[model samples]
Target: MYPTNIKMKKKDKRKVAKAVRGAIKAGIKENIKLFLNTKKFGRIILAKLHI
Candidate 1:
């Protein structure tokens, strides 16, 4: 598989980080965030872990 190109500069990187930080600050749980981040392995694993 070939690598897909995604472009970012330092400023863009900071903006993305800031957005993620804001989300974290706004009451989003770390586990839920992790599940969302997995891109497919959704809440099932996290739910099992938490239970």
Candidate 2:
């Protein structure tokens, strides 16, 4: 029983770590999307100016 409990605790720790990693990845993706959108918008504006 004690061994099983220990194993469960380890699994929980792994799950928490994976969740944290996924959150970080999601944040980075969001930032990249925002950056790309802004860049495209700027390009469009520049084109309108015939630059």
Instruction: Name the candidate that leads on TM-score.
Output: 2
Candidate 2 RMSD to the correct structure = 8.1
Q: Which candidate should be chosen as best, given lDDT against the real structure?
A: 2
Per-residue lDDT tens digits of candidate 1, residues 1-51? 976786788899999999999987765677556756586566555656765
Candidate 1 displacement at residue 26 in angstroms: 0.2
Candidate 1, which segments miss by more than 4 Å at Cα? 1-3, 28-51
| Per-residue lDDT of model 2, residues 25-50, tens digit only | 99997776667557978556555765
Candidate 1 lDDT trough over 10 residues, lowest sum: 39-48
